[model samples]
Target chain A: MSEQIVSDSVSAIKCTNCAAPLNILGGGRVSTVTCEYCHSVLDLNDNYAVLSKFEKVKRPLGPFKIGMRGNIKGVEWTIIGWVTYKTIEFSDEEWNEFFLYSPTHGYAWLVYEDGKISLSMKVRDFDLFSWKVKKPKTLFYKKGHYILDDESYMFYIDYVEGELNWVAKFGDKFTCWDYNGVGYRSLSIEKNINELEVFHTTKLNKKDIYSAFNLEYSSKSKTRKDETFSDDDESPSVFNINKIFFIMPLLLLILAFSSLFYSKTVYDTSYRTNQKENFSIDSSAFLTSIKISVSGVGTANNKLSLYKGDEKIFYIDKQKVFFIKKDIGKSWVSNAIAVTIYLKLDKGRYHFIGEKNPNQSITTVKIEQQVIRTNYLIYALILFVFLLSIPYFKERE
Target chain B: MTDGFTVEKSINCPQCGDTLPLYFKHVKLVQCLSCKSTIFLENEATRLAGDSSVLAPEISLIHLNVPFGYEHKSYLPLGKIRYSYGRGFWEEWWLKDSEGNEYWLSIDEGDFVLEQKVDSRYSRELFNTLNVGQVTFDNLIVTETGMATCEGFEGALPKTVTKGDTYLYTHLSGKDASLTTLELGKDGVETYLGKWISPFDIKKVG
Candidate 1:
C-alpha cells in the first residue's frame, strides 16, 4: 500500500530525552511525542517536556509498527499510535485502540476487543447531547432506527503509548451508551464530563481487516473473540420474506379480478311446468359443457331427464313431501317441503323430459341452462396464498 | 533460548549509566530500571540518552515468558510500545531472533499480527489520490479502512518516531493467512508484510 502523510514534507525533531532524530508524522495535530528510543513522553506544545515516562509493558508486539502504513478503504493510513483501555469493573477486560491516519480523512479508530475488530469514526453531524439528555430508549437517524444496546462507564485507561489526538488521562470516567442497528452498524454515545460525542462503528471481519491493512491473512487467527450484541429478531432473510409476503395478497386480488374477464354466458333459459313437459335444445359446439338448475314449490315427485333419442345422457330428480307430526306439548303441525336439483351436461343435442305425480300439484317450476365456466384465477389465487404462507411460517420458525 | 540462541551482551544505560541488557544487535531502545532512564543504542560503541513513555501494564490472560516458535523458528520479545490516537489505543511488541533479525508482533483485542519491515518506498501522491475501498499496492490489492492522527506513545519502537505522528495505513492479503501492512509516515513509506499467528505459536521456554 502507498504510505502517505498529511504533510507534504517531513519535519524532523529531536527527542527531548534521547536527542534521537524524531519526525512528527502527524504534522500539527500531535500534542505529545513519545521518543522512539528512550520512551520519553514529551509534550509537543511545551518544548517537548516529559509528560510521563512509559515503563516497558512486556507484552507481545503487534504485527503493525508505529510507522508501518497500510491502505484501508482505499485510503492510505499509517499506524501512528495505539492505546489499551480496560473496563473499570473488570480490570482483566481490555481492548486495544489503533489510531489510523490519512491525509484526506484526518483520523479513524480501529478497536479490537475479544478478537473482534471494529472501525469507528467520529460522527460530527450527530447531536448526541440532545439525544443523551432526553434519554430515549431508541434513536432515529438517517432512516434507521437504533435501539440502545447497553450503557456503561469507562473507568480505566490501562495503557497509552502512541500519540493520541485527545488528552486522555488515566482513571477518566465517562458514560458510554451503545446503540445497535439490524446489522453490523452501531452508534456509540459517549457522555464525558461536559460533552457528548457520537461515533459510528462498523464491525469488521478479520480477513477484511487483514486486507485493509495488507497484513498476512490467516484464517486460524481470525476466530471471533467476542460474541457480538446483535438483534436476533432482525434477520435479512426474514425481512425480505415479509416484504414479499405483503405483495402476494395484492397479486391474489389481481388474479381474482382477472377471472371476471373470462366469464361468458353460453346459455340462459327459464321454464315453468305444472305437469310433465318435454322439450329439446341443441348444444353449442363452442361450449364444452352446460349447467342446468331446477327449482320449484311443489308437493309432488318430479324427475327430469335428458336423452339423445332413447339413450339417457343426464337426469335430475326433485322430490317434495307434506307431513303432519304430533308433539307432546304442542298441537298437531303440518309442513310442506320444496326441493331443487342441479345437473351438468355434456355438449350435445338432448331431449328434456319431466315426470310429475298428479296426486300432488306443482305450484311453480323453473329450469335454466348456462355454460359451465371455470374461474382458474380464483384457483390460482388459492394456490398462491398457500405458497406465500410457507415463507411466513418458516420465518417464524 | 528455545532455538539454540543466546544473548550477545549487556550494556549500561547511556543517560543513567545503569546496566542495559542486549538480546539482539538491532534492539533500538532500552529502559533502565535503576534510574528509569531510556537509552538509545546508536551503534556498537555509541549510546545516547533516550526519551520514553510509560503505560500501565495491560491486564491480560496471556502472559509473556519464553521464546515463541513460529514457522519453524523462534522469536523472543524484546520490547513493547503502547500508542493512542484520538480516543483509542493499541500495543505493538518488538521481537527478535538470535540472528539479530527483528519482527513486530501486534496485539489488539485478540487479533495477532506478525510483521517484518520492508525496504520498499512509495510516493505520497499515490496515496493522496487513492480512493476508498480497494487499491493495488506493490502488486497486491488491499482495502483502505481510514486514516488516523497520531496521538501519544509509550514503550520502545523499531524506528525513529516523535510523539504526534500520523500515517496512512493499508493492508494486503494473499490466498493464505499472510498479510501486509503499509505505514505511510511523514519521512517515507514502509511495508511490513507478515501473517496472523495463532496463540499456540507463542511457546513458553524452559
Candidate 2:
C-alpha cells in the first residue's frame, strides 16, 4: 500500500487484502492490524499479510470507539484496537477489551465487563510469598491482600478489530487466573503459548472515564442479572429500588388529600318540630351528588318534601333506618331513625319542607354533597401500594 | 575490588585518531568522543569497530555518568548498550551503587529490571532447551526468549559489545518477582540474578 509519510498523527497505510485505510497508531511495535472494514487480520510486521478472517461476527456494543484520545491516570492514550472475548467455561460470559497506546508508556488495556470499566497494566513486582500455582488461596499486590475468586479459567477470542501489538486470530485462546483484592483492584495472570503476563487492574469510576473522553456523564452502569456491586465505584444499575422508598409515600399522601377534599358538606340545616330549609347546588366535578338525612325516633311517619325552583322532584319520608343504640349497649335497640336521599342536582337553588304529624316525633335533618356515594379511597390506596411493590421485590432478589 | 575508583587514562581512537577520556571502571568497550565509532579492548590491544548507532534518547530516564536513586540507595550509570529485536528495542545500563557494588539495569519501554552477575552450575545443554513460559525443574518460569542485535553503545562495558553483534537471551522468573537472565553469544552463556524494579522508584539523586 502506497502512503504518504505525514506526521505521526496521520496515517495512510491501507490493508493489503481489502485496501481499506488502516491507521498505524501503534507505530513500529505493532505486529498485527485487523482491517475493520473486511474483518481481515493483517500482520503488520510482515507487510500486512492476511493472517485470519472473521466471518459472521457482529459488532460489539458499549461507549467506546476506536481512535478516541483520553487521559487515563496521568498519561494520555489513544484507543488503537478493540477485541471481544467469551469465557470457555461460561460461553454466555462476554466482554470488550480496548487496546490503549501511548508513545512513552507503550501499550495498555481497558476492559469493559459486567457494566464496569477497569484499567489493566503489566505487573512484575507481584508479592509471591503468599501464592501457589494450582490453587492460590491468596495474592498480595500493591500491598493489598487478595483471595482467589473461585479458580483460573480460559477464554476464547470471539472478535478482533483495528490494530494489536501481537498476532491474534478470531479463535485464539488463553488461560487466565484472576484474584480480586481491596480498593477495587484485581490481579490476573494470563498465559499463552508465547508469553506469560501478570496484570494489575483497578476499576475506574464512570465519571472519570466519561469526562476524560468528553462524553455525557451517565451514572448508571450495565450489569448482568447475577452480578454484584463493589464499594469504590459504587454501582451501575438500570434502576435503584431505594428510590421507591422515598417517592411512594409522598405520592400516597397526595391521593389521600384529594379523596378528603372531594367529601365535603355543601349545605347543612336542622329540623325544629315544623320548619322549611333552602339549599343550592352549583354542581362541580367534586360536588355532583346531593344527600339529605332525616333523623327521628319511634318509626315516626314524619316526611320531607324536596323541590328544585318550585318543581318537586320527590319526597324522602322517614324509613325504618335505625342506628344501633349505644343507649342500651345490650342489644341493637332503635333509638333514632334516619332516611337519606341522594340526588344528582343541576345548577339551581332548591328547598325542602318537613311536616310533623300530631303523633310524629322528628329530631333533626342534615344534608351533604358528595362526588361519590361510597368512599373507595381506602381500597384504592391499598391497591396502589400493592402495585408498586412488585418491581421493588423483584429488584431486591 | 576497588571500593574507591582508581587512576583513569585517555585512549586514542584508531579510526579517527581522536583522544577519548575514560572515566568508567573496567572498560572493555568505548565509543570515541569525536568519531562515534565503537572501539573494543582485545587484551592489551585496542581495535576499531563499526560506527555506533544511537537509539531515540528523548524518552530515556537515566543518563550516562549521572547518579540516580533506587530503593533509597544511590547509583551512577557508567555504560549503556541498546539492543533491537523484531518488535522493539531495550537498553541495559551498567550501574554502580554508593557502597561500591555494581548492577545491570535493563529497561524495556517503561518496565525496569535490575540484575547482578551470579555464579552458576547450569550447562549449555540445559540453556538451549528453554523456551518462553516453560517451567524448569527448579520451578523457575522462563518468561521471554528472543534474539537481539546490538544497536548502539555508550560509556564503558565489562562485556564485549561491538556494534551489530547478535545474541540470544532468555529470562526466567522465580519467587518474589525475582528473575535470572542468560545472554548467550561467543562468550557463552552468562547468567545474572535480578528482580523487576518499579520504574517510579528510580529518581535523579541530588
Weakest 10 consecutive residues of candidate 2 chain B by summed lDDT: B1-10
For A22-98, candidate 1 gives per-residue lDDT tens digits of 76665346677666567677887778788776665543234445665666655566666777776777877777878
Write one digit per residue (lDDT tens) for candidate 1, span B71-141: 66777776666556443455567777656688888665434678898876666666665554354554444
Against the unseen true structure, what C-alpha lDDT does each candidate score?
Answer: 0.57, 0.70
DockQ of each: 0.01, 0.25
Interface RMSD of each: 16.6, 2.8
Best TM-score goes to which candidate?
2
lDDT of 2 by residue, A1-397 (tens): 1112224564668889879888877755678888888999888777778888988367887677778778887777788889998999888899989988776566788888766788888878774423545446775565565667666899989988888878787778898878765446678888777666788887887668877866565444344521565424432121222344446656666756665566656666555466777876766443343343334443455666677777776564444221121121222123435544445556678777776754345446565665554345556556767766654454334
